[model samples]
Target: RALNVILVLQCERRRFLRVGLAVPLLGTVAELREMVAREGHIPPEQVMGGMGGTGKGRDPLRATEVPSAVPQVILAEVSPQGFLRSLGDSEELGAAGEGAPLYAFQPPPARRPGTANPSPLAGNRGLHSLDWLGGQGLPASPGAAQPEAQHPLPSAARSSDCLHRGASSRVLLLLCNTVSDGHRLTRFGPPLVLREERGISWEQLQQSILGQLRALLRAEARAQGMGVPLFRIRLAEGMEPCTYLSPQDPHPLCHPAIDRALQLSGSGGPPHVRLMAEWDLNTKERLFGSVQGEAVEDAESVGLQQQAHRQQPSCTLDECFQLYTKEEQVRGTAG
Candidate 1:
């Protein structure tokens, strides 16, 4: 019976291990001995009693039947604290150890706001201003048609001496503005206008502008120099709404004029230039709605009061002369 109990407990321990559960050690041994004594194979008192038997010389069979000593097995020597410490050390060593350079293993540091790397164009400052004389043509004017002429516009010229200059030295000026109609203000993209006071021919200006534009757009580094002053105006809003100009989809403020200018310049040929201006009318209110009729009436009353003050007459030159003559006579007698 005792053997049967030991076998049952061993089976339970094996089953626990298989199912990933912890096994109890000393309790299992005690239960096995109790079962053996209950079966009448051995006396319960002898098994239950402490390891030493009664002083009287008991029968050898009874003594041998119940084992005097249980062997001890060392399952594991590690404490919970020691095991945790070992695991932590291994992880720390992997992170900052000599196996890999710390800088190489770590992620790069973030850049500060507005501290981005400088542009390549920083070196090409003077190239922006070099003038190239290309052609003689009619001066640009607003709302005028181009006159028919036989000679084609001249191409830009280049010199061997000025190849190393940067864009800053060449850039004349940059201007930016927004277009709005009282109610709504809309942004417009930058329009770059480059000018050269002297030295470069018209052909050179065209070539330089084209070359610079290609660089700006990140196109091929070199191409035939277009011989004209180039003007690029990008609309703050994209091209779609402005090109269509539908009332259902209102055009962005600056887009209309910018789009028109680009179209005209492409078709009209070289020496392209355009002027942009804003027009305003006091009668037009914000797009949402107009002021009420009563409000307009009140405004008119206030305006009349302002007009009356403006029209009122003042003392004339004759009155001032008479006053001055009386003062002069009194002063002469006193002297």
Candidate 2:
């Protein structure tokens, strides 16, 4: 036993993410997500898209890496206008800003129920009938916030004809007031399950979304007593884009700046994360914002994200980005 020197090294068991504060780590993505949701003061369910996204790579969930003693990754919450105001060109992302990109988080496909690797939401605590987004600032159309009322879901036994999965289980129904046919359509989703995995094919995430939409449609059909068989469902255009903020560091020099973003988005900070995004049409609003460069391209993989069908949406759409794109063209032409 020639043990020359015994070193007393302080080790941390739980990996923590350096967000607004130092959050403890959990096993699965679902658990990690809850922490993020709490920090951002968002509804657990409404914290979709990049709720648990690392956002540095192709898969958001996969980006949730093991936490280190020091917060290795920094989650910087940049406002919509600030998002456009990166370390680049003018207020508008012009030809000089052509290379400037905006990023979004998309979860990878999850594995089937019985697979070798566990699902992304392996520890998903499918809390029964819990409206996780109850207190969040979900607007009730025309400057009204949704009343603090718990609209309990019908139990499985009562919802015999309802295709709404997790209705009896732990799922989050996202209420989307999408812009469809030049009008807003109040559509509630395919409930999202807390614990699910993204398999190699990434179909797992798609299945969750598509399956929920079908269930909701089926319930609506039965409620109306409509006898027409359901075929397919597609998200309408002109909806806003939901983007997640991820850290981009070729090396670790930018870690401090990342931390700063987290601080700014945390308590008493800016509107880093939002639910219903409207376009940032005012060029002046983009002032004082920095350029993010390559980090902007992080959202490029969004197209590769898996979904139910080619026409179906993998994530919810708001109205912010649409407004900017549509109005920017008109403004450019007029000016």
Specify the highest-lDDT model's number.
1
After TM-score superposition, what is the CA distance of residue 42 in candidate 1 from its true location, in Å?
99
Model 2 C-alpha lDDT per residue in residues 112-200, reported as the tens digit of each score: 23544432234432221212222111111233222122112221121122222222222111112122223332222211222221111
Candidate 1 vs. true structure, TM-score:
0.16
- Candidate 1 on 1-335: residue-level lDDT in tens? 10111110111111101001111333342332233233223322212222225434456545533333211110111111110010111122222212211110000111224554332233322232312222122222243232112122222122223333332122121122224456753323222234432233333333333432232222222332222222222222223332211111111112233324334332101112232212122211211122211100122323444555567566779987886666434445655
Model 2, residue 86: C-alpha shift (Å)? 17
TM-score of each: 0.16, 0.19
